[model samples]
Every structure is written in structure tokens, then in C-alpha cells.
Target: MNKRFALLLLVLLPLMACNKQETPAPAATPAAAENAAPAANEPVPADEPAASGETPAPAASAQTPAPEAAPADADAAAAAPPAASGALTPGTDYVEIPNGQPYLPLNGKVEVVEVFGYVCPACAQFQPLVNSWEKKLPANVRFTYVPAAFGGPWITYAKAYYASETLGLVERTHNDLFKAIHIDQTLKGERGQDSVADVAAFYGKYGVDPKQFASTMESFAVNAKLSKAKQWAIRSGLEGTPTIIVNGKYRVLGKTFPDMLRIADALIAQESARPAP
Candidate 1:
């Protein structure tokens, strides 16, 4: 029975996250191709080509569809489990980030940041779970979304995310954007060469002017946030999307989506228990 359980975990692990890789430019090098190899811990191959028009080596594909769930039912699916207890095994469940710090300045609250990209299908799959999970969080915990800028369509959506955020449209459009790309097919995923205008037109349905949305996507402020997000991903040593960082000190590495939240709950408890600085 134990062996069967372990084997089941192996099969499910690859489905829970998207591997991060650089989309090769036209003048790509052999060394660049070598760098695109899947990490030792990641077994899935890259099936979706990046929007750069050059196919990257096999890693996890970003085009996989998330399981279907009605929008209204997502919260019930994400209801928080009872508080986790006992010491969770390090390295196995999660790894500590050396010199890690919150994505934003500490504000007398525990910070939980999810590093995700709109173009990552794995992230889209994890969205419903996290959306509900976050809603039940205590007032003392702050949840922040840091978009991943992995180049190609990733940069496009990252820019769109920041622009929407600047215009205060993210709270209304976040999930719909995911549905548009992954389910509705109204928007394209990382595989498509989506431009700023394409993304802005989608936002137009929500009352924002398309031209205004497009301009905001390229604004200096949005560019700064995009740059900061890239740096945060680099400093976190992020190798995939849908990663959870608790208080910026631990990176959750659970084998399944629910398991990831379970681990994150435990870490949040641990951080909450620490004496105030």
C-alpha cells in the first residue's frame, strides 16, 4: 500500500506545476539549449512551444487545461482545512530560502506570496484552489500575487496584470482572464503571440478603454512592477510557476495542489507563532 501511494505521488507531481525556462531568441546558442533542460526534480517534458517562434527543449508544457469547476463552487473546493500541526519535514515538503524576505515591506502581518504567470496552465489550475484558500485567511496574514515574467507571451500577460492592477481591475478580472485563456479560448496561452493590444481588448469588456489599457501596459509604473517581479522570482530561486512562499522564508514544495496548501498552512502557523520583531 505504501509503495502504491508513493507511485501515485510521482504521477501527480508533474501535473501540479509548470517548469520555468528561457524562451530562446533567434540567435540562440547551444549553451542556451542546454540550460533549458528540465530540472532534475521535474520529470515532465515541455510540450508547448513558447511564443518566441523558437521551440524550447522539453520541460513542462504550459498548455495543459485545468480541471473544470463552476466559478461559484471554487470557494467550497478551497475551504481551509483545520490548522496543520507538528513539524513538517524540510527538503521533502519545502525548502528554506536563504536570506529570504517578503515581496513587500513587513507591515505587522505575515506575508504569503504566490509566484505565478497568467500564461502558465499549471498556475491556472492552481487558481481556484488558491482563490478560496486566500479568502479564508486571517486578517493578520497578507497575500500578494507576484506575476512571473518568463519572456514571450509571459511578458505580455505580466504587463497586462500590472496594468490591470494599476487601474484597479485585477480583482474583477483575474479569474476570468484565466478562464479566457484556459477554458473559454477567448485569449491565447503562452504558445500564442499575444500582444498588448490583444490583452487590452479583452479588458475592454470590463469597461476600461482598450487604448487606455494598452497604454497602461507599457507605462513606466507598470514596467517597474514587471521588473521588480522578475527580480523577486530570481531571488527566490524559482524554477516553476504556482510556487508558494510563506513569509518569504520557506518555499512550499508539496507533491499535490491540496498538499501544497496544507504545507503552506503549516508554515503560516509557524510564522504566526514567532515573537514579533
Candidate 2:
């Protein structure tokens, strides 16, 4: 095997070994888009109530008496649409984040953020599908990508992403970087060569100055973005890479790629129906 492909296997094999159970698929939908969920109890940053969309639930002070049950009418039951055929199920398909985080949408659009990582195989696999789905989204749906910054080598990738944005290279390099790492297997995570310095060198070919790239990677501005990203991932109730947060309110979980997009479509419709601001 080529050196790059070999290195990738080395990085991925260990992660596979540590994972004992695959991510539990939500209700069955499609097989193509299935990805293992990040192990439960993975270290999530403590929730900061002050963060947008992260309002903590208020403590209940009292319990009220139970209400009387209303009479069930066969007519009403027949008139109601079946829940099984619906596009989404609250709590099952997606979750409502407490106090919903604030979203920054352009031109009064609803926001959709894909919380993903470059090193993740699932994210890479999901990219083309998401890219196509994104293009077909309504003009009112605003989309952005937030690289996972949970630390270790992934932190380096996140820094690289932000740095590329700083240098105006993201649009050109984002997909290419994924291609390099996953398909081409050229961007291996070998220790000495996978650091920020290494990422700078790789992007250098795209006209980024290595010195400037390294500096930008560590700059306070980039760090601030990273901090916000970390908080968003934490508050979005993100259990793993490839999770989708819609309007800072819902974290979509799907059994298939189409299922995920279907959930997102429904959430977007719901968000679009909300009264302004």
C-alpha cells in the first residue's frame, strides 16, 4: 500500500477497535447513510446557559393535580393524520435543544449547521450527499459547516479549517481536503506530519503562505471561532461528527442518508413557519 493509505488505516483502525457497538440506527430507513453514533458519555463540554440556544430548563417548584381525560371520538381519530407516515417524530427522529440556541441566518433565512470532522469516515461519506442536498435547499435555508474540535488530531483539522477560511482558501480546499484525506489518502495523520505545521504546508500549495497560515492558526481570532464552535457542538447536544443541528433547535438523527435529509427538510419547514425573530 502507498504510504498515505497505510497511514490512514493506522489512524482509523484504532478508532474502530475502541468502538464496541455501532451507532444505533434510528428507526430503519435506508442502509446507505447509516453511521455509528459516537459512543454515549463521550466527554462533552459543560453546558453554558449563557450561550445562545442553551437556556437551561427551570426547576419545577410544584406538582399540579392530574386533569380529567377527554372522551375519545372515533371521528376525531379517523380525521387525524397517522403519525407513522409523517416525516418526523419529536424525541425519536430529532431532539429539541433546551431554550434553543440563537442562529445567525443571512437575509432572514433559517440556519442549518452540519457539525462534522474531516478525519471522520462517516462525514466524508456523507459529504457528497449533503453537498447535493444543500444545493436543492430553499433560498430561505442558510447552511454552514462547523468542524468538530473535540481535541487531539481533530483539533488540528479544525484549526486548519478556520485558518483556511482566514486565508480565503476554504471554498477551494474544503472538499479537496476531504478528498485528499479519504479518497486519495494523501493527507495521513502521522504524528510529526499531521500537526498544524503540517497542515500549513499542505495548504501552502494553494497559495497560502506557510508563515501566515501558521500564525493565523494560532491567532486569537481563530481561537475565538474555535471556542464558539466547541460551545456550539456541546450545546447542540452533538454526540458525534456528522450530526445536523437545525436553527439551533433540533439535532437530527436518521437511519439513512435520505432519512437525515428528510428530517432536516421537515425541521426547515417547521422553522420557516415560525413568526419572525
Candidate 3:
């Protein structure tokens, strides 16, 4: 394996040994695009929310009822002792996050969609690690990427994603997408900081049409998919990037990733045995 690949594996393997609680994050809005300069060097989001969607709020943000009328599951978990039981049952514990303004879920698939941007350095580091994890995914699982368009240069990278997926160049050229932007710094917001055609054309060398790709990047179809992805991320109670959601309800966040796959597996197994809705 190349040194970078090895380093990435080493970094991700330890994640299995730890798990992060899926704490709720602030509501996603275009105001917080990945590359947007924060006020006075403040922190920023690793992935930006898509333009045309609104994700569901997390459980922590759920409507609170009177203490006397507490929800059954909440009371049960709180009253039960930890040594004898676990917290929250699948399905009963959480609800589905709707896809924003657009796409709906594909039937009979366990989605593992990732929300990422080519220009984010943290996203660059996450690429190889998630790719390795994908290779070992179960037959019932499905994986997809939500290319975000929060900033001007970001939309260009988003176009590259659509073109690559359309032309079957994703697996071969995916990693390079990030490297070309972050490592080599070749992308300088082409077309006067508003157009992504130059980079989309670069993917065209691998057989993608820059114009058609641009249209799809802004298409209703892509918009719906982006919306759903945001919903999935939000319902998963994501605190940051690199979160994974199983089905529309069960989510893995924080130090979750591959390691949290174990808990995800447990939840999936249990859900599989339950009666269908």
C-alpha cells in the first residue's frame, strides 16, 4: 500500500475502539458553507449544507411535553438500569429525517451517504478511509456521496462529482478530485470565482461533458439527493463531518465511522427481525 493509504488506515482503525455520541449540531444553512471565512478566525464546518433542503431536527431538539406526560421510550430508558439493558430501541428510539426539497429514499437499501466537499482538507483525509470501508460493505448496503455547493469554488467541485458519477469515473478519479484541489492547489475558483466549468472540463478528459455536467449539478434530481443527504445528516445528530447513517433513523457519528459499524450492525440486525411498517 502507498504510505498515505497506510497512514489513513492506521488513523481510522483506532476509531473502531472508540465511539462518539451523536450530539445534535446547529441547524444547517447556506450561511455556513464549508469554506466561508468565519468571524475573526473562528471554526468552520467541514461540509456545507445543500442549497435546497431542510433536515429534521435531532431528538435533543424534539418538542418537550409535560413531565407527567413523558414519552414511553424516554421514560423507560431513563428508569431502566444500564447494567440490565441498553438505551433506545431501533425505530422506536428515532424517526426518519426527510430528504430536503427533493429526493426520496430508494426502497430496500441501507444508505451510507457521505456529505463532503473537495476543498475541505479534512474531507480529503476522510476519502481513502471511507473508500476502504466501502469495499467491505454488506450486500444490502448502499453508498452515495452528497457533493455540497455552499461556496463558489465548491459548486465546481460538485459539478465534477456529478460528471464523474455520470461517466463511471468516480472510483478511479474520486481521490484525485480532492488531491487536485487541496494538495496541488490547482483550483483557484476558475471563471472569476463563480464558475466550475474549468474543473468540470478536467473531469471531461475522463469522458464527462462540462456543459451537461453543469446542468445536472444544478438539476432538480441532484437537488433532491442533496436535500435527502442533509436530512440524513441532521437526523443522525451530526456534530460534524464523517457521519454515517443507516436506514433513515439509525445514525453513527463522531468517532463512529467504521468502528461504530459494530453498533450499526447490531441495530440493523435487530431492525431486520422486526415486523415491517
Candidate 4:
């Protein structure tokens, strides 16, 4: 009976120890699972939205076209294809001469001269376009116009140009008058006193004193310019109006003023490189 009681007590003690060990393992398993779950499902921080707000805005660089683009476009176009070796080629109605050098002086101290008449349609076309080129022109270069008095009617136009010069309205009314007559078809008069009066009225409309304008047109100072222009016209091979002489040498016809400028530009570049005066 004593042996039986002792055997039962030993068995119970061993079983109790095993049960205690098993209970600790089950408790440890639930704690480990809780720690692992947080890593995969991490909480979004409260400052995430604020941090995104701190990022910079996308940039905008250019807005409008550069002011130099128009002239630059002209420069690119002025890169004219080289002319074929020539001496009176057939099928080519050539304005440039066989023996003559390119009109624009592409050397140092280039000079530009305008041979024009106010009533001339072609000269009127060239005034504004040439004026633009004048703005970008170098200081070393000089520009002059031969307001040729080839005829009685042409004398009035030359005098008008001289009047505008004295009044400082060349830029404002130079192109405007051209368009007024040619494009808009405004100026109308016979080649006489009526025509002179009409043109003076046009100047007056732009705020020039009509009396002063008329007075200057008849002045000795204006007459001198008209006389010199007539002399240049005889010497410059100018058949008609709107001939632009570059550097006192090459002459370009101003049929289309912009095209005239292009030819003039080419000649001017060449003139700019010559020995200084």
C-alpha cells in the first residue's frame, strides 16, 4: 500500500512540470505575433501631408519672342546662295552688273546712301523697311538720302523730305505717308502748286506748322540738298527713283524695300571690312 501511494505522487509531479512549460510557450507565441503585425501595417505619420506641401512648384521659363528675332531672321535669309560664275548669262534678267562689285560695302566704315523721291511709289515702299535697318546700324557707318530733283514735281518731294528732317518727323511720317499714298490711296494731286500744297497739308495733319513747312521747302538750305541729289542721280546710274547706293560705290535698286535692305546688308557687310576712311 505504501509503494502504491509513493508511485502515484511521483507521476503527478512530472505531469505538472510538463503542463507549466507548455503554457509559457503558448503565451510567448501571441506576443511575437502582435510585434510582427505592426511592421507590415505601419501607421501613416500625421506630418506626411505637410511634408508633401513643402515641395516646390514646377517652373516656367520663357514667355515672349526676343526683340532681335526679326532682324536675325533677315540675317539668316541674307545668307544668299553663292551666285554662279557669270558674264551675261542667258534667261537671267540680272540687275547686278557683270563687271560691278556687290553694292554693299562689307568693310570698315561702311556708308549707305538713299536715292529716292517722295512721290515715287518704290521709294515710299523702302522708307519704313530701310528705317528699321537703320536702327540696328553701326555708328561708324553713315546713311544719307539723295532726294533727287530730277523733275519739277520731284523737287517738291525732295523739299518735303527736307522739311520732315527739320521737323524731326522722318520716322513717324516717313512710312505713314508712303502707306497713305500707295497702300491706302490717299494722296491725289496734279504735278504743280496743288500737289505741293496737298503734301504740306499732310505734314500739317501730323502737327507740323504749315507755314513753317512751306517756308522751309523754299529755303536755300533745302535747295542745296535738292541740287546735290540731282548731281548724284546723274552720276549714280540711277534711271529712276529708289536707288540705294552703298559706300558711294555699289548701287541697289529698291523695287521691294525689304529685299533692297537684304541686298544692302550684304553690301554693307562687305564694306565694313575695307580699310578705314
Candidate 5:
């Protein structure tokens, strides 16, 4: 039984995160493509998968795959899930982020930032779990999503995210956008090139004017946010999507998806226990 369990782990371990590589240059865009910078390569977790669509590494045959189709009600999969619980060992479960700081000012709350990319299949798989987890966070804990600025479709998606947030449409379109890219095949994520107009049209289904959406994707405001996101990823020492940083101090290194959240829960508790400054 122990050997069986170990074998199972060997099979599943590599699918936990999307590996970062030398990002391909951004494809031409109708707007602001020139502003998109190539993401710098950083060290990924030893077990992370290779670039999207490539064959899996020799040791692990199954890489992160697009998430299974969500039910008609997307929230149904995440509704009222049990809280994650586990004890954490410093070097085993997580490591401190070197020179790390919160992506935003803490004010009075504990900040949990997820560094993720829309084109990342692992992020798509982790979405439902995080969706439920974020919903249950206490008022004093703030959850923020900072999109990874890995180039190609990654930059395009990051721009779309900032534009949606600016337009007050993120709350409505977040989950569906994941579905569109991974499940419905309506949007090309990492598989093919995407333009500003292509992403704008996806948001159009949610009632925003496509032209305005495309323009906002290139707006100075959105560009500023994208730059900030890129800086945050670098500062966090992020090398892959679906990374959880707790209070900008600890970078989770769990052995499984649930284990990642469990360590994060313990770290959040630890941060909350810290005496006020």
C-alpha cells in the first residue's frame, strides 16, 4: 500500500503548477502590443511541468491539463467546501520569499496574493478550490489575484484582467473567462495567439462594448496595473502560476493542491496571531 501511495504521488506531483520558460515574444496586437515586455525566466519548483502543449517530461507523463467542464452553475463545485487544515513545517511546506512585501499595503488586513496566469492550466484547475477558499476568508484577510505577465497570450490576458477590473466586470466574468479558455474552447489561452480585439470580444458577451473594452486594454491605467503586476511577480520570486503567497512572506510549497491551501491556512493563522505594530 505504501508503494502504491508513493507511485500515485509520482504520477500526480508534476501536474501541480505551470512551469515558466523563456517566454515567446508577444504576437502583434491591434493595440499596445509594443508595451508588452517579455517575462524574465525564474526558477520554478522542481516538480513543475514544462511549457503548455509540450509533451510531459520523461519521469512524469501527465502534465497539467485543461480543467474538466464546469457544471452549469460554476459555483456549485466550490460551494461551502470544508476549510483546509494542516500543520506546516517551514522547509517542507513553505519557504520565505526573499525580500518579499505585500502586493498592496496591508492597512489592517492580512494579504493573500495568488500569482497566477489565465493561460496556465494549473491555475484553471486550482480556480475552483481558491474560489471557495477566498469566499470564506475573514474580513481581516484580503485576497488579491495578480496576473502573471509571462509573454504571448499571457500579457494579453493580464491586460484583459486589469481592464475588466477597471470596468467593474471582473466580479461577473472571472470564472467564465477561465471556462471560455479551458473548457469551452471559445478563447485561445496558451495554445494560440490572442489579440486585444479577441479578448475584448469575450468580455463583450458580458455586456461591455467590445471596442471600449479593447481600448481600455491599452489604456494607460491598465498598462500601469500590468507593470505593477509584473513587478510583483518578480518581487515574489514567482516562477510559475497557481503560487500562493501568504502575507508576502511565505511561498507555499505543498506536495498537492489541497496541501498548498492547508499550509496557507496555517500561515494565515500565524500572521493573524502576530501582535499589532
Candidate 6:
């Protein structure tokens, strides 16, 4: 009986040892449990959002429509593949003004100056387009018109513009003057034909006192504006009428009229990112 009991005890003890080897033991301490936890630290890509967090905002596109060469070039532009999104090329698309001229913004707003001439057929063509574009411009931008005073009858036109401004008749006669010269062809812009009297007479029809118009054209204030416009034109490095200067820093250049506005739009976007001067 003793021999049988000993044999059973040996077999049972061996089975208990095997069971203990198969089972897992609890961690000895809290620190050991933490050390056993899995961990990972991955970096987020610059162009991609993080793996676990609030979604990031969409990035601005880097590509823009290339400048159109001419009205007929529209088809060619449409056919070309889009250029990669990036900053605009300097000297090719736009030339930076040599000296960073201080901008005299109105009401603390960024200024966009249009150097145009009344006698310029191109300016006349750009008028309606710009007029519409300016209306839709953000309130933070101030659109200013500076009539080019290039020799010939343009000087007289510039004086006429300032006179209208002085007499508070510019808003009423601005488009009228353009129509009078372009469509109506009644207000001639000849070398000597469109005299100061003729220009003042044109404003007379707009309810401006002819005497006031004539005298205001020669006022010191009018002369100052004309002189300032001449300086602006020269400093802008304009080879033609209808040149646009943004914040007095960049001279916008584009192949088509619409492209000109597009370039301006891009420049405004860049300006919006800058800290206030």
C-alpha cells in the first residue's frame, strides 16, 4: 500500500509542475506594467495631416494660370498643361520697383494705383473691365486712378480729371468723359484741338460750373496732383498706359487684360499675408 501511494504522488507532482510552467504571472509592480506597454512616435509629413488629431486646413494651391499672350492666345493657354503652383517669377511676369517707395494708402488701406490716360485707346478698352474689377475688390484695398500726363493732349485730360475731382463732378462725369471721347467721339483728344476750354466745357454739361471747372484745373491742388501723377508714372517705369502698381512696390505685367487682373489678384493675396507696415 505504501509503494502505490508513493507512485501516485510522484505522477501528480510532475503534472502540477507542467501546469505552473504553462500559466503567465501578473507583473510584480505598476512601473513594470508601464514598461511593458507598447509605444510609437511618428513624425507628420509637411504636406500631410497628423495621424491622430483634429484635421488640418487645406493648403493654398501653388499653381496659377500662365499669362495669356493675346486675345487669340486664349485657345493656346487653354491647351497648355497647368504650371506647378509656386511664387510668381520676377522680371519675367513682373518687375520689382528699384526703391521700395513708401505707400500712401488711404484710410489705412492698401493702395492699388492705375496709371492711365484718357487719350489711350488701350486705356479706354481696359476701362469697363477695371471698373468692374475695382467694384469687387476687397474693402481693405483702395483703388486710385492717376491720369497719365504724357505730353500732347493727355496733360489737358489730366487737368480736366483733377478739375472734375475738385468740383465734385468726377463720379458723375468719369464714364461720361470716356464715352464722350471713345464712343461719342465728340470730345476730341487732338494735340491742340482739345483745349482746356473744350475740356472744361465737357464738364459743364455734367452740371459743373464752367468757370469753376476752368479755374480749378489751374489750381495749386490740381497742379500738385498732376505733378504727383507724373512722378508716379515715371517711378512706375511704365512704357505704356494702363499700368497697375500694387502698394507702390510691384508693377503688374500680364499678357492679356484679364491676366493683368489675375496677376494683381495674386499680388494682393501675397500682400494679405504680410504684417502691416
The candidate that achieves the highest lDDT relative to the unseen native structure: 1
Model 3 scores a TM of 0.55
Write the residue-wise lDDT of candidate 6 on 1-277 in tens digits.
2567544543332121101011112332212221121221211111111121121111111235567555457787788877655357666446678874623644566778887767654465567778788999987888888887765567788899888877788778887777777667777753135878888888888777788888999899999988777665656555555677888888876654566677788787778668876
TM-scores of all candidate predictions against the true structure? 0.72, 0.71, 0.55, 0.56, 0.71, 0.67
> Which has the higher lDDT value, candidate number 1 or candidate number 2?
1
lDDT of 1: 0.72
For model 6, which pairs clash?
62-85, 62-86, 63-85
lDDT of 1 by residue, 1-95 (tens): 25675445434433333654445454742334533435534433222222221223212223333444544676765784543465576775677
Per-candidate RMSD vs. true structure? 15.4, 12.0, 13.6, 41.5, 16.0, 35.9
Residues 1-277, candidate 2, lDDT per residue (tens digit)? Answer: 3568544544443233112213332343222122323443342211111211111111111224355344388787777666555456566567788866844544678889887777765566567777778999998888988887755767788888998988899888987787777666567632223767777888998987888999999999999998788766655555655778888888876554456777888889888988886
Candidate 1: 10-residue stretch with minimal lDDT: 45-54
- Superposed Cα deviation of residue 68, candidate 3 (Å): 24
lDDT of 5 at 235: 62
The runs of at least 3 residues in candidate 3 whose Cα sits more than 4 Å from the true structure, single-residue gaps closed, are 1-106, 188-194, 215-239, 256-266, 273-277
After aligning candidate 4 to the native by TM-score, how far in Å is the CA of 217 from where it should be?
0.4
User: For candidate 4, lDDT tens digit of each residue in 1-277?
Assistant: 2567544543332221101011113332332222111121232111111111111111112133333333357667688555543212111111333344323444656777776655554344345556667888878777876575644455577788887887888867877766655555566311223366778888998888887888888888888766655545544445444566676666653213344566677667766766666
What's the candidate order when arranged by decreasing TM-score? 1, 2, 5, 6, 4, 3
Winner on TM-score between 3 and 6 is 6
Q: How many angstroms is residue 173 displaced in model 6 relative to the true structure, after the best TM-score fit?
A: 1.2
Per-residue error for 22 in candidate 1, Å, reads 21
The per-residue C-alpha lDDT of model 6 at residue 89 equals: 68
Candidate 2 wrongly placed segments (more than 4 Å): 1-86, 103-107, 190-193
Question: In model 5, where is the ten-residue run with the lowest total lDDT?
Answer: 53-62
